[model samples]
Target: MNDAVRELYSENRYPDLSHPVTDISRLWVSARAGGLERLPEPAACRVLELGCAGGQNLLPLAARYPKSEFTGLDYSDTAIRKARQASYEAGLHNIRFEAADLEHWRPSHPCDFLIAHGVFSWVPDEVKTRVLDLCGQVLSDNGVACISYNTLPGWSLRSGLVPLVKALANNPAAAGLGDSVESVAASLADMAGGGTAHAANVQAICRDMVKKGPTVLPFDDFAPVCDAVYFAQFASWAGERGLRYLGEARLQDNLPDGISPHAFDRLAPLATDPILLQQTLDLLSGRTHRNSLFCRVDAMLEDGMTTGVVMNFAAGRGLVELPPVESRVVGLFRQLLEEIAPSCLAMQELVERTADRLGAGWEPSRHGRELTGWIYQAARLGGIELRSEPLEIRSHSMAAPRLSALNLHFAAAGRPVVDARHFPCRFPDGHERLLAAMNGSRAADELAEHARAEFPELDFHRWLAHLAERGIVE
Candidate 1:
C-alpha cells in the first residue's frame, strides 16, 4: 500500500467495507462460467485477501469454509484491529488477519485464489503494478484472481465530479469529506438549475454522487490518486505481468444481453477480437465499474461450460418458474422449486428429482437432458445459480434452526445484511430478532415465544424453514 493510501484509510476509516463478491468460490464459479479451466475447489483452497478491512468481507467466507485457510492483509492498523476482534468473536480458527503493506509483504505459500476489490484504482501506478506482481508471485498454477476497479467511458462521465469535489474539499469550514462532497454536489445542482441540456446532465450526475454515501464520496471520488483505467489497457498491463485476463466476476457482464441487436451487430465486425469487443461493450453500455478475473499466461480459457459444473441459489427470491413453452413441465418445475428452494442442491440432485417426479415410465437419460437445459436457462435468468461447492448445511436436533456463527454475530452487531451461500440477505423487520435469539439453547417453541414480543403474528417454524431455504440458517 502507498503511504498516502494507508494514511487516508487509517485516518477516516472506511466503515463496514466488504465486497461479498470477493468470496473465492464466487470468483471461481464466475471464471468457470466464462470458460476458464478447472480451478481448485473452495473447501481446501488457500485464499488471500488484500486490503481486508475489518475482515467483514473475508471472515464470513472463512466461517463458511472452515476447512480452507484464509489470510487477510491490510496496511491500516485500525482495519486489522477490527478484523482480528471479529475473528476472535466468531471463533474462526482457519483464518488470520495481518497489518502489512503490500510493498513489503510476500506470500509464504502460493494461494489457490486471491482477491483485491476496491483497492486497485485507489493507489498509485507503482502500487497497482505491485498488485499484479504479487498475483504473479503467489497465485497457484490454476488459481484465479479477482481485481475490481473503476473503468473508462463510465468513469469518463463520473470523473468530471472529481475536480469539483477536490475544490470544495479544500474548504476548511467544510465539516469533512462527506460534507464537502455533499456541498459541492448541491452547488453543482444549483448551478445547473435545469434549463439547458448540460444543466440537466450535471443534476443527474449530482444525484449519482449523493447516492454513493459518505464513505465512497471521500475515499473513491475525492482522493488525491483516484485513477480510472480503460479495460484494454488493464488487459494489456496484466499480459505484461505474466497474467492473462479471464473475464468479469459478474458473469452477466460478459454476455451480450445488455445492448441492442443493431448496436452489437455494428460493433461486432469492427472489433472481431474478443478483447476489443470488451472495450467496445464498455463504451456501448457506459460501464464505469468492473470486477475482473485473471489467470496465468499459459492457462487456456476455453469458451464453453466445464463438465460437472455445480451451482446453487445465493438467496431465496421466490423462484421464478421458467416460462411455459410447453405445459407438461410446469408442475414438475414448481415441485422442483419447492424441494430445492430451502437448500442448495447439486445439478445431479435436480435432474434426478425431475426424473422421479415424471414417474418410473420416464427415461432418465432423455429427460435429464431436457431438464438440464431448462435449469440452465432458468439460471441464466437469475432464478437459480451454479455453485462451485455444495451449501454447507448444519445439523441441529432442536426445532429452532441453528444459524451460523457469522450470521448470528452479524445480526447481534446490527449488520443490516449477511451472506447466504455468497448471496446477500437484508434483514427484514423481525429477522434480526429471530436470528439473534438462536443461541443453541432456544427450541422452536421458545423462539416463537421470544419472537411474539416483537412479531405477534410471526410463525417461528415457517420462518426457520424460510431461513433454511435461503441457507441463512446454516
Candidate 2:
C-alpha cells in the first residue's frame, strides 16, 4: 500500500514550493510564545522531516543556517532526486534527502526538531503510527515536533465531498482524475438544479475542489486512506506514544480570540488543561486543520511565556494598526510602528523605546502585561514579528549586500519563496534584480549605478532599506 502511494506521488509529482510556516523557525517562535522553554536553537539544531516532498521546506533552513543539519525522508524517488538536484544547484551542503518509507526506515541519530507536515492524515494507519513512533525515537529530550493534520468537526463538512467524489470517479489514481473531478462536479451541479440542499452542498464543494487542479484532488480530498480525529483523540493518541501537546504552530489558535466575550468565563476551568482547551476552541472556530507542536512527555515546562523571540514576517504585509476599531491600543501600536517600521526589534527593546518616546520614568516591567498584549496583537496583524536573533541592517557604507546562495539561486529560478537570512520571503513584486545585484563582488556605488540605470523611478536607497529590513541582504 505504502509503495503504491510512493509510486503515485513519484509519477504525478507534487512539486510546488511548500509554505514557509512549516519551517522549524516558525514552530520555534510559536512554541516559545506558548510558554515552552529551553528549545534547541535553530542555528545549531538537527532537523528531520518525514514525507518531505522535494525538500522545499528544509532546503531554505539548510541555506540559512549553515551549522544546522537537515535530513528529509520521502518514499518518492523522483521527489528525492529533484530535492538533491535543487540542493546541488543552490550549493547547500548541510542537507540530505533520502528515498525511504516511514514504516521501514530507522533514524541514524536524534534530531532537535521533527516535522511531519501534510503526511499524517494522508497515509495508512500503520504508517501514521510509525511516524509518531519515529518522532519518539529521533527527537531529543528538549526537542520540539510539529505535525499538521486534518481535524474533525471542521473537516466533517468537507469529508462528505470524498464519498461523492469517489462515487463519481471510482479510480482516484486515473490519469485524468483532475479533469474527471471537474466534469463530475459540473454534472452534479446540473443535476441539483439548485433544489436539493445536500446535492447543492456537494456540488459547491466539488466546484471548489476543481480549482485545486486534478493532480491534487485524489490525495487531498478523495484519497483512499485519509483520516481525521478530534483534538482530544489526537492528544490521547500522542500521549500513548510518549509525546504531549505543547501548542499549535499558530499561537493565536492556542489562545482565546475574545470573539465570544464569555468564552473564557464558560471554559476557564478547562483553560488550565491543554487538550481540553484545544478541543473546545476547535469546536468554537470550526477548525478543519491544525499545525500542532509537541514534545517528549517529560520535557520541562517554562515558568512563563517567552518575550525573547522576535516575529519573522516582514511588516505591512498584512499587519496594520487601524484607528477606528482598535482605538484604545492604536496609539501604542502607531508609536511602535514609527519606531521600528522596517527594522526588527526584541519585545523588551520595543517596549523600552516606546517608554522613552512617551516620557520620564516609563518602565517596561510596569507595562509588561499591556505591552505583551499589544505585541501579540501586532504579531497577529503581521505588522510586527518576534525572533530570537535581531537582523543586521545593511548600510551604504557596506561594499555590497550579502545575500545567501539559496536566495540568489531562487531569484534566478523565479522560485516564490526565497531564503532571506534565516527566514523565507514571499514578496509580491519579487526581488530578482535586487538579488542579482547582491553578488558580493559589487560595491555600494557600483550597485547604485546599476540600479539607477535599470530602474529610473525606484528609490534606490528605499529599495536597499526595504531589502535590509526584510533581512534579504546584510
Candidate 3:
C-alpha cells in the first residue's frame, strides 16, 4: 500500500501553495480561544509540517518569520525534493524538508507547532496511529497540533464517489482529474437526481476540488485511505493518546448554522458533553470536514479557563453575519463596527467604545458581556477575526508604487503570482502598458505618468492599491 501510494504521487506531483489555516498564528489563536496560556509566539517558534508536499505552506511561513525554525516531512521523495528546491529559490535558510513517513520520522526535539493538514484521513490505520502517537510524543508542553479529517454522515454520500475517482486514476486514456472530474460529476449528478443531497454533495465537491487545483484530486478525494469519523470518536482517539481537543481552527465551524436560538436552547441542555455536543451539531448540520486543534491532556488540566489571549486580540472585519436578532444593543454594536471599516480595534478599546457610546446606562462591568457575546457570536458566524497582531495593509496607495519584480514578470507573462494573502491569483488581460511600466525601479512612476495617457481609463492609484492588496506591491 505504501509503495503504491508513493508511485501514485511521483506520477502526479501536487502543486505547491500556502494553506493559511495550518499557520501557527491560526493554531495559536484557536488554542488561546480554548483557554491555553503561554504558547510560543508565531514570530519565533519551532514548527513542523507533516506531509508538507512542495513546502508551499511552510516556506511562506519561514520567509515571513526569519527568526523561526521549520521542518517539513513527507513520505514522498518527489514532494520533498520540490520543497527543498522551492526553499532554496525563495532564499530561505530557516527551513528543511525530509522524505520520511510519520511512523518512523521522529525528531530529536519537539516542535512548538505541528501541522498535518491533509494527511490524517488519507493514510492507513497504523500510520494514523503513528500520527497521533508522534504528535503526543513530540509536541511541547503548551504546544498545539492541527489535524484535518473528513466527517461522518456528511461524507456517507460522498464516499460512494471515491471508488469512481480512484478508477479514473487507474485509467490509461484519462489524462488528469481536471477533465475527468467534470464528466464523472455530470453523470453522478444525473444519477443522484435534481435537488437530492447526493447531487448537492457531488456538485459542491467537484467545484471546490477544481478551484483548489489538481493537487487535491489523488490526495484528497481518491487517496488510498479515506476515512471519516465523528467528532466524538476522534476526540476519544486523541484522549487515548494523551491529547485533548482544543478547538476548531475555523472558529465559525463550531456553530450549527440554520439553527434558531430558541431551538438551540432546548437542544443544548441534552447535549452537555462538549465532544458529544459538537458531534451532534455536526450530524445536525451535515458537516463534511473538520480542522481540529489538540494539546497534551496534562497541559489543558494545568491551565484552567482564562480569556487573556482572546480578549487582547486585535479584532477586525465587520458584523456581516450576525445571528438572528432584533436587540437594539446588537444593532448599535453592528453600526459601530460598520463605521470603522477596514480598521482593526483592540478588544478592550472596542469594549470601552461600546460602553461610552451606549450612554451612562451601559455599565462596562455588567453590560460588557452583551458586547462580548455579540463579538464571539459574530466571529463564530465568520463575520470578524480575533488576531494577536493586526495585518499591515496600507490605508492608501503609494504615489510611486513599488512592486515585486518577480510578480510583475508573472503579470506580464499572464501567470498568477501568489498574492499577499498567500493565495495564487493572476491579473487579467489588457494591463500591458501598466505592467511594463512597473519595472520595480523608480522608472515605474515616470513611465506610468506617460502610460497614464495611453491608458486614460486606468486609475493608477487604485491599481497600485489593488497590487498592494495582492502583496505584489507595498
Candidate 4:
C-alpha cells in the first residue's frame, strides 16, 4: 500500500480515542426520548458506527443500553483487534466489531441510529457515497444519522496551504514527508520573522494546520482516501440520498453566537433553508469542522429536546451555573414560549420559541422566570433532581452567571472515581467557599471542623464522600 495508507493503519499514529461516547449516548437517548429528564421507553435500538476505531464509541453505548445492539465497522485490522480485546476484557456481549471496508460492506438489517464521526471529511468520494447510501438503506423509518465533516468557506482559508505543504513534503530528495512538512512549517514561521503580511498569512495557515492537521490529515484512519467537500456540496449530496439536514450533533455549534456576527448576519436570513444557511455560515467563518445530523425524508420527524432547555434546567436547579444568555435574547425567548402550544415540545419548537422570544421583547426578569419553569418541568420528567440540597437550590429568579467551566467526573455504581481533567470551578452559592475549604490544603477533619462552625447542618464527611465519588478530589 502507499505511505499514506500505511500511516492510516498504524495504531500509534493518532491520539488515544476519547470521544466520550457514554456522555454522547446519554445525550442522544435523552434527546430522542424528548428531554434529558425522561428516558425514552426502552426500545431495541440498533446503532451502526462507521470507522469505529477501537470501538471506543460503540462499546460505551452498548454498555449503557444493554438492550441496544451495536455494530462497528472499520477498515483497519489493528483497530478491530484492539476493539475485540477491549470488548472481551470488559465482557461486553451487546457489541460486535468487524474489519471491513465500508465502501464495500452492507448491513443485513436496518439500524435505528447511525454515527460517523471524523469519517466524512477524510474518506474518498466513492467511500463517502457508499457510507451515505448505506445510511439511507439501513437507517430505520424513525432513525437519525450523524455525520461530521470538514466544510468549505471555513476550510478554504486553512486548506489553501495544503497543496504547498504537501508539495514541499513530497520532495523526497530533501527529507522524509513528515520531516519535510514540519521543516517547511518551521521555515515559513522563520521567514515571516513576525510582522509582514506575507509572513502573517503564512503563519495563519500554518497555525491552523498545526492545530487541526493531526486530527484530520494523513493520521486519520481514512486519510488515504479523504476528499474534503464544501458544506453546500455536502448538503446537496445528502439531499440527493433522501436525507434532510436536522441540525448539528454538537448543539452549541448551531447557536447564533457560535459564529462571528458577520457570518450570522449573512446566514440568519437563510434560516428557512437550514442546510444552505449552515453552509454559508460555515464558509464565511472558515469553519473546518462540522457535526451534522441528517434524517431520512420519509422518517417521522420527532420533536426532540433543545440544548437551551437542557442547560437552562441544569442551571436553575444548581446542577450547573447558568450560561451567558444576553438580556435581549432572554426577552425573545419568552415571546417564543408564549406563542408555542404547551404540548408542542419539540426541538424545532424550542428553536422557534427562542427566535420568537428574542424578536418580541427584552425583559430579563420575565425571561428568567419562564426559563426556570421550563427547567422545573424538564427535571420532573427526567427523574433527576434539580438540586441535591436546600442550600444548593436558588429560590429567586436571579441568574447565577457561569464563572468557569467545571470538569465532571463520574463513577459507575462501585468504581473508584477521581477527577481526571482539571476544570475551572465556578460556584454560585457558598459552594465555592465549601470547595475552598475542602481543597487539599486542609485535612478532612479540619474541613469538617470549619463546616460545623459555618454551616452546622451541612455534613462535611458526606460532602467529601460525594466529591470523592465524583473524582472531584484525590
**Which candidate has the top score in TM-score?**
3
lDDT of 2: 0.70
**lDDT for each residue of candidate 1 in 1-474, tens digit (9 for 90 to 100):** 567776788798775645766767667777776666757778888999988877878887888788999999988888898788878888999999999878778889998888998888998888898898998888888888899899987787678777866677677765443456676686666667889855776787787777776767777776767889999999998888888877777655565345886786687675447689899888777778888998888766675553344323232213444455573453575566565554455556655566677776566555545555555555555555556655544323346567677767767876644556555565566577678877677777877787777787777677676666556664
lDDT of 3 by residue, 122-168 (tens): 88788889988988898999888999899998888678766775476
103-149 per-residue lDDT for model 2 (tens digits)? 88999899988989888999888888898898788889888889989
lDDT of each: 0.72, 0.70, 0.71, 0.55
Instruction: Output candidate 4 Cα RMSD.
Output: 11.3
Residues 1-474, candidate 4, lDDT per residue (tens digit)? Answer: 345554666644343343532234333533343322322222367788888876655664565457878888988888888778766756678889999987678788887678887777676666778888987888777667778777665556456576677777777664643465655665565566658755676776675455544544555322555456777788788888988776665444554233655656666678677767776666545566777777777755445554444442222121323343445554444344334312123333454456554655534456545654554443433322221111121112111111111111111111112121112222334555656433245566776777799788888677665454333554
C-alpha TM-score for every candidate: 0.81, 0.78, 0.82, 0.61
Worst 10 residues of 3 by lDDT: 301-310
- Backbone steric clashes in candidate 4, count: 14
Error of 4 at 173 (Å): 11
Which of candidates 1 and 2 is the stronger one according to TM-score?
1
Candidate 1 residue runs with Cα over 4 Å from true position: 1-3, 165-180, 183-205, 256-258, 261-272, 300-303, 306-324, 327-335, 359-378, 392-402, 411-417, 423-437, 442-470
Off by over 4 Å in 2: 1-3, 166-211, 255-259, 306-333, 377-384, 391-403, 411-415, 419-474
